[model samples]
Target chain A: MLRDFVKNIGYDDPLEICLSELEALLQYNYRISKRSAALLLLQEDPEMFELVRKNEAERAEKIFSIIEKIKPHYSYPLAYIISERRQREASRIAAAVTTVGKKGSLGIKEALSRAMMNPFIGGPILLAVMYYGLYKFVGNFGAGVVVDFLEDKVFDQHLNPVFIDVVNRFVPYPVLRDLIAGDYGILTLGFRYAFAIVLPIVATFFFAFAIIEDSGYLPRLAMLVDQIFKKIGLSGRAVIPLVLGLGCSTMATMVTRTLPTKRERIIATFLLALAIPCSAQMGVILALLESRPLGLIIWLSVIVGVFMIVGFLASKIMPGELPSFYMEIPPLRFPQPSNVLRKTWSRMKWYFLEVLPLFMLASVLIWVGKITGVFGFLVRLLEHPVRWIGLPSESAVAFLFGFFRRDYGAAGLYDLKTQGLLNGNQLVVACVTLTLFLPCIAQLLMNIKERGMRVGVAMSVFILFFSFGTGWLVYVALNLLGLNL
Target chain B: MVQYDKDDKKQVVPLSELKPGEKGQIAYLQAKGKNQMQKLLSIGVIPGMSVLLVQRFPSYVFKLGHTQFAVDKELASSIHVKPVK
Candidate 1:
């Protein structure tokens, strides 16, 4: 039946002649039929070409020469010609077998899909999604309510005291005890930050993200943002990784592989490192600025401004083909609760497992740095820049923590906020700087793995200076403008 | 600028020129690269298929059979289509 189908749906004269000539030359047995192999060879499938070259040896050259001879017979590519012929045959077969029904009226789903993509309505809908999904639920409920309960009630009240007591009683050496349960100890700081702070925020974010993804809104969102993305040297397809960057930049950096061009991937990676904040950090920032809405607004504006300006500059400076956009707009539907929950649970599990070890390692490293006094020296060194940005010297600890994990730094800032060390302006400056700061260690490794060592290190170095430069500029501007909030 | 089919002398326009709700039969693709052509072909945007322009702002979205697709203006402009009355 397959042979008959291939024979019946034959190509034009030139292709048919080339196929036979190539088929006759292909003496080695392939997994697929000789005819199919010939067709793929004619289409210039690179893998097939390599396979045939290896298998058929000298015959492969003859096969390729036949393909070259057939190429000039058409203005379009042989692959396009062959595909078009196949589609025509498929359409004919479909028309013969299928009957058409009268098209139905545009249903409520259709209208809603249209409304979701309409520019006038779409902008507001996007804001609503962000406001509710990101701000209210993830920020307030997850970061605010859950983090408070876990950090204060569970860890601070019950878990930490018990763990500290056990370690102090049993552990004989002061160094080992301090390493396990001291100020920057694995149990007190590392486990506490991961389980109490980062976990809740990440869980809520993944849940909300799963719902949005299942609803089929992301493609529409991509369509709506395609023009803006083009300005940044990316196609709308990039929206996936950029949005995923909100969940976790490390994973998003890995996802940048889906982009077609190297240039787009580079630009996407740079922007993710510099501007996009992961959920844990965003959650903490939201909580920090919840009291001062104006501070939140300023932070939002500065980050967004930096995102656009840097992206535009990158696009202009980097030489490459402009990314073309095309995507299937999946119909909008109500997300299934079970599916959403399962997706959220799996993502949360994956994220937690990946982050826990890193957090603990960061704790151990911090402890070592403290014992060696190197951590204090680094903090003191950072204090100059921290002070230059109009933040108090103590906030240097937060900046140092930021290099380990972006959220860790924001959580540090959150600690300072509780101490009332940060005023309104200082709070916004800290948030912006930390949000644009170097990616965490895991993300740095991922960037190197994905983009190679040189580009990864170069991007990190640029981001380190650029983030502080932007922060310093924001501070100077705020002081110059005399805006109290 | 109006484009005319040299063989039939019929007026054809880039798919981007079609207004929302307007219908057209795909005539040919003026793709500049093989990659662009393959992308359009893979998405079922072949010649002879009927397409309905669904939206024209922010991006050009069109319906082919039961599926809807969104393409930026540049990709949309590569597709030449004959308007259906």
Candidate 2:
């Protein structure tokens, strides 16, 4: 039956010629059928090519030459042409063999799916999702409420004093004490930021993201945003990476590999680096701006405007054909609780493992730098840019922390906010700058790994300058307008 | 809907131009790059496959079998198709 099936399915002329020639050449006993091997060869499937090269070394030359000979015969790619032939044959066989069932009218799920893709309805729905899922849940509840509880009641009240006392008594050397339990210590700062501030916010974000993904709503959301994305030279497919950027920009940077073109990847990377804030930063910013709605609005508008303008300019500057997007829209269904929980757990584990060491390293580096006066020097220099953005010079500390992790910077700003150092406008400026600042160290490394070193360095440098420039612009405009929140 | 070379005078239309509820059989794939072609092929959008326009508001969503695809307008336009009754 399998042999008969293979014999009956015919390919196009060029592919057929190549397939027959490959059948004549390949002598080794492949795991798959000769027909399937031929088809795979015709499609230039790399694994098959490598296998052919290894097994049929002498005959591989003729097979490759046949493929080269057939290349000129097709207007479309060989893969496309061959796949089309297979699809046609498959469809014909399917139609012949199957009977039509009664056509069902569009059901509730279909209607809901369609409503979510409709621009008018979907736009408001998206905003609601962002507000409730992102702002209210992750920002207010997780970051504000939970972080406050963890940092104050749990860590500050109980754990920190205990650790400091124990480390002070056991570790006699000042440098070693500072490294383990002092001002810039690993336990006090690094573990505190990761566990107290970042963990809750990231956990909420992953939970929401998992539910959305499982519900099959992402594709519908992508459809709703496709037009706007086109203007930025990205297709709807980029929604995956962009949404993932909200969870963690470092992971999102790696995910950009799914984009089809180099230009799209570069543009996406730059936007992510410059505009999109990760969950922890987002939660902190949202909490900071919670009492001041105007500041929040301004921050939102500035960041969004930058996102669009930068994307538009980058697309225009980088020469590439407009990205083409096509995504399979799975049927909408209630997200399974088990699936959602499993996904969220796995993501939280992955994220915690990835960030724990980085946070520790950052603390150690800061400790070392502070001892050598390097950190103070850098903060003093960064004070110039901080003041330029209309922020207090003390906020320079946060900017220095930002280089290690965006969340760390936001956490520093949170500390400053608690101390009543930042007013409404300065708070907004700081958030804007931090949001648009260079991505975390991991993301920068990922950008280099994925997009190559030159593009990565260039992107980071461009972001560093552009973020401050935008922050300065916002600050000057706010002051010039004399708008007090 | 299948038009051979003998019926050369008939105008060809892009699949993207089809209205919702309309059906079309794929005719030619005028992809500018291998990436475009490969992506379409990955989802079984190839010449001679029948497609139905499901929605076209925010993006173009088409149905092939029970599988539906949401594609950008420009991407859809590259897929030439013939109207089917």
Candidate 3:
């Protein structure tokens, strides 16, 4: 396609002379136009320089000297000067071709957008969205009602007994039968947890996220939190990944690649690993602490306090440039129903597919550990730390399960809570510890893959100690204060 | 004459100092950090470009070519502009 307006390549006389001189020296077959290639060369693009070296090997040195020679003529960087000229010409063309509508009166949409960005109004609006969309819709409706129906009615009553009976009748050997339908078996534990518990929570969270995202509210939310984020050594740009971490930290870990600086990415990753709980874990935790408001408050304060402290410390430790953010805030529009539903469906499908096999594998691993007595041994080892955090030794099983998947561990905690095994203070300590625990296997792999082995392993080791260390402190503090509920 | 020009240049302030709803023509962007300069330049915030301040809270939101960009105070200070009459 022909551009409507020509890009005046040389903004000034010296630039024009350099472009022509470099264009004449070009000998290679290039993908883009020679004009564009010459412009890139002037921008000091490394790839273009290599291409020129390979194609125009003899005159590559001359091209280099020309760039060097012109450096003295301009006070600014050559790249900046070139880009500035291009922007000037482009803006001129844009203004010439486009006719804007009546300007003067701010429309309702503008008023609404302004209100959403205003701090006093935006803060309350954010809380309202979280309360209605996340707490009521996702927590109560999806996690509480839907999960109860699926888990208690569908899987527990009908599916498990039938599967166990069938497996018992068909399989003669006890070990093989245990593998198929026993406790911790693939069908009984894995499928039940994945379908009944995690699925509903994840689906509702993704649906809520998609609606907010499509409405163009995410950027406004980013703007609202930019100040708080700056103190953590990140700009508003990091909000996307940080907010998305609540939906799925594994995915959010990968999204950290979008951050501008390595320092910002590392800090964001560490925080995500340490404090953020994905949707399924969050739903279960909310359900666990629903009755104990004080317990819930304590959990929130400790986790948020750790997030801020760790982020600050990490930013200080990792010396790099503070990230400068610039984002195009799209105009707010009513989310199209079809778009929101499609996005929600696609994300749910992707998440379900990624987790299904892993959950199954985890179940099989747990079963194997059980038969070999390794699970018992591991549970015993975890019991010491569990007790140290003021949790009953039985809660050790949940902490063990937590390593496989955060949601699964949270489910284990839920079971113990139902059995009336944990007290309020112990419950609060466990929740805080689990919330600050290491990222799930998927997130760990992602952290290693994104940040490499050294940093990734170091981060997990630090998180492990920090989570337990914080839990111990909370336990002692609770006892000392005599606030045991 | 030189003194008058110097005085006039002093009247131009950093983009960070502009009140919300103000408009300015970018005069000079003296970002000391290389990456910061590159980031701002890539977003078309060069000298001679014009921007309208959208909001000055939590962060500074501005408009250029129908697109709104947000930058914090530190980054905003790096951008120098002469307020539009």
TM-score, chain B, each candidate:
0.90, 0.86, 0.87
Quote the positional error of residue B60 for candidate 3 in Å: 1.1
Would you list the rank order by DockQ, best first? Answer: 2, 1, 3
Clashes of each: 0, 0, 0
lDDT of 2: 0.87
The local distance difference test score of each candidate is: 0.91, 0.87, 0.87
lDDT tens string, model 3, A224-327? 88888878888888989988898999989999999988999999999999999899999999989989989988998998899898887777778987776667
TM-score per model over all chains: 0.96, 0.92, 0.95
Q: A116 in model 3: Cα distance from truth in Å?
A: 1.9
| C-alpha RMSD by candidate, in order | 2.5, 2.8, 2.6
Question: After superposition, which runs of candidate 3 have C-alpha atoms over 4 Å from their true positions?
Answer: A1-4, A7-10, A50-59, B1-8
The candidate maximizing lDDT is: 1
Model 3, DockQ value? 0.56
Q: Mark the regions of model 2 whose C-alpha exceeds 4 Å error after superposition.
A: A1-18, A27-34, A44-61, A68-81, A92-100, B1-3, B8-12
